[model samples]
Target: MESIYLPTSYRSSKNLETAGYFEKYSKMCPLTWGGSSSDNFCRILEEMALNDFSEVDLSALGASCSINKLQLPSEPDNFPIEVPARLSTKSKLDFYYPVTTEATQLNVIKCKEALEKKWIRSEFKFGSKRSLKLTITDNMSNHFRNDILPGTNFIYSILIYRPFSMSMGQKHSGEKLRFAMEIEALGTNLLSQIIDAIECVSNYGVLKEVENTKVNLKQFQNAKQEYPSQTVFIDGVFYNDTRSPDAEDYSEPVIKWAREKNIGKFTVSAMETTLLNTLTPRIGYPYVYIHQGNCEHILTFSDARLIQPNDCLVSEKYPRIVSVCRSTNVLCLICGIAPSQWLVKKCDRFPQEKVFLCTDCCNSYLYIDGKKVGDFELYPFFDEKVT
Candidate 1:
């Protein structure tokens, strides 16, 4: 794999007089590299050059030792200069994206190759070795989620879902095998680095924009244009439903309704989700799935609203939701899917209480309100009070 050469604003010296000892020096640096920001990393690296001892000689100092003291090792052999080994981060980037138009089979292969063997070496100014081995290595693999919705999978590689992700296109039901390109190195700005590398070696591009598609609820012939129990609005964007327009709703009746209508497919995109989450944050993130009827639904939070709902709470920052197992308060109790129709049953423990169940989990037997209940059988011990 050829290392993708990305244009970086910052570069470090590979030929400083102390270059030979950097490997040993890095081991002694006090800064935690993996978690530090790019600017902090560079600052720390500069500090190393200022006092080479800060990099190499301080290894003998215990964790409590002060860097200002700059203690030298009592035993020279303990700090014996060894061949410079390339330094890398213990973390690896797992690049997973649906195979969309912006990314093709050939593009995926090129990226895989670049990430597997290519090393992104740094360009040094004064060192005799112009190319310094930057923190990038070809360590990648392919994988799939233990559970993926059958229809178009709007797969994402983000650890924490970001709003910007919504602008990108999505995968259709036919698409499979999300490209999980793994790159390991000791540095930051990995996403930018990968984009640059792919651009250099291959035509594969990321974050490609597609023509926006308006959602049609008619496809889900059974569902009304009704909103969910909770309506949230942020920055002019709204989140109202759990499933796509044509897809099955979270409640059993709604799902059965859509199934009876013979709804075949549904599509949702990260772009749609980004629209909703850009302003509002929810406990559940956007996800894609294939339903029992083979219908595809792209879920952002639960569902999004193009038209503002009559009732909604507006906020500027991401709002947090406390974990509760109630359907009306959130989504489905079972899968967390958007609950269109809810099953109301008497709590086994508190006869006065009502328990809500989503469509899929309604008939499914499970423990509710501290007691076991049959599909459609109301538990006698469960409490209706959610909370």
Candidate 2:
């Protein structure tokens, strides 16, 4: 049977690269390319499709993964000629996709075909090679926490959960996906806020601004106005080096390389993500049904007994809960949907200790002293300069 294709999760992308997308160059200079920032976002995301890290100049990003220095190639391979190939390998700009069990790579083969817009060949390749032998480790759970909620799943909610979840846009249910996109779009701005937005949304961010037509909380329906989360994710870049501390020290090759990558891959990818999410349905995956009543009941995390009534430390942030989980100290979600309700009730009822109330919106309330503190938000923003 002809199989259907879902967008490959970042996990798959990482796996493909890990299996050997850009591995050949590991021997010498592992110079790879990153696209532009204007239209693309080069950050990495998790299963929820929420970004944790984006466009980092490999050198400046401070190589964190395990490293094995490459032996300078000029040491011998026909050395008398003073060749640089010993330090670098060539690669090309291509598209990636997962269809059925197969993944395909498309490179710009004809020059004229790429005349107006182009993806350069980083070094050189033989028979239409488009991938490298780079390995992508799956450290998603290590980086993303249950608290970091992305955006909502409008299409999925309506299609997959409408029958059971009550409404597509429940207050606290099924939001991570949409939230991630929204945050990625502007959250990629000013690295710190991007991080905070990520944190606010991550470990414990809120989603407001979803249109009224989506979901109308009975309580909020009568309230004045509230902000819902918007969902947007753009394409980005990955640079090869850190910018010179002294601005004047910048080199033309580096500058040009930056521009080229952005224009060719980064920009293209960003535009596509934007266009698709805005105009298309089912942005990437068909919502996978986990249960009957609510995904939040199963997908969300909550632990209440973690906080002792005597543990009175003030937290200015989400002043809604007094405590959350014990070991992780994360926020406790009673149910993914209608979560604001947790704030109004006494959640310390041991038998139901896993539940609690967040009166943050009630009056001088915040989300401190709970397990939600310091969760992973979308990380390392796009190519924007960090102050």
Error of 2 at 286 (Å): 7.2
lDDT agreement of model 2 with the native: 0.24
**Per-residue accuracy of model 2 over 49-127 as CA lDDT, tens digit each:** 5445455744444354312223244444332323233434333333322232311111222222333122224312231
Error of 1 at 166 (Å): 34
Tell me the tens digit of each residue's lDDT in model 1 across 147-169. 21111111112211111112235
> Pairing residues by index, what is the TM-score of model 1?
0.20
Worst 10 residues of 1 by lDDT: 199-208
Model 2 residue 23 CA deviation (Å) reads 40
lDDT of each: 0.30, 0.24
Find the number of clashing residue pairs for candidate 2: 73
